[model samples]
Target: QHGTPSSPGELAHHATLSFSYLWAGDEWTFTDARGAVTRVRVDPAIHASNGDLLRDLAIAGCGIVMQPEFIVAQELARGRLVPLLADYRTMDLHLHAVYLSRRHLPGK
Candidate 1:
C-alpha cells in the first residue's frame, strides 16, 4: 500500500521483497554514493523461487522486489515497474558454467 523505499533504512518501513533460494534470508546489501556498504534484513511478506512470479507480484503492487534489470526490463520500459534506491547499488551476481570432464564423457 506504500510507495517504494528510497533508501536502505526505508526498507524496514516497507515490505522488502525477494525471491529465489539465493535471497532466502531476505537480506539485501547495497552500496551508497560514498561507497559505504549497508545490509538490510527483513521478513519478506512473500517469497518464491521464481523471478517471473516475483516480478508479476511486484507489478500487481504487492511490494518492491529486488530483481535483476533484465528480468524486469520490459516492465520498467513499459512503466509497469519503477526502480527504487537509485542511489544504492546491489552486489554483482557471478555465474559459472559447469560441464563434465572429457574423460567422463561417453563415446558417441
Candidate 2:
C-alpha cells in the first residue's frame, strides 16, 4: 500500500451531516472527541463540499467521512474500509424528491 491505513484505533472521529437547501452534500472535517481532525483543511485543488468529493477523499486515504450507505455500501461489503465500529454506523441523508413520484410508481 502506498499510504498508511486509516488509524481508527488512534481516535474514532465522527462524521456530521450538513443540511443546506443549496447544497445536498459537503466534505466536512472528521473531528473526533480527542480533537484530532483531518481532511478539513486539505489541498485547495481538491476542495470539495459534496458527496462525490467526500467519497474521493475516503478512497484517496485523505481521511474518513460520513456518507450515505448507497455511496459506500459496495465498498463496505467488499472490505475497502472496514467499519470503524460495527455498532456505530453513521450516514448522511440526501433529501431527494421526484417531480412525479406517483406517476413513476411501479406496479401501480
What TM-scores do the predictions have? Answer: 0.84, 0.43
CA lDDT of each candidate?
A: 0.83, 0.48
- Prediction 1 global C-alpha lDDT: 0.83
Error of 2 at 52 (Å): 2.3
- CA RMSD (A), model 1: 2.0
Per-residue lDDT of candidate 1, residues 52-103 (tens digit): 9999999988888888898999999999999899988988876589987899
Q: How much is 45 displaced in model 2, in angstroms? A: 12
lDDT of 2 at 92: 38
Show model 2 residue runs off by greater than 4 Å.
1-47, 89-94, 100-108
Candidate 2 vs. true structure, TM-score: 0.43
Model 1 ranges with Cα > 4 A deviation = 22-24, 99-103
Tens-digit per-residue lDDT, 11-102, candidate 2: 32333233232442343334455555543321223334576666666776666555667777888888775555333323334467767668
Model 2 residue 78 distance off true place after TM-score fit, in angstroms: 2.2
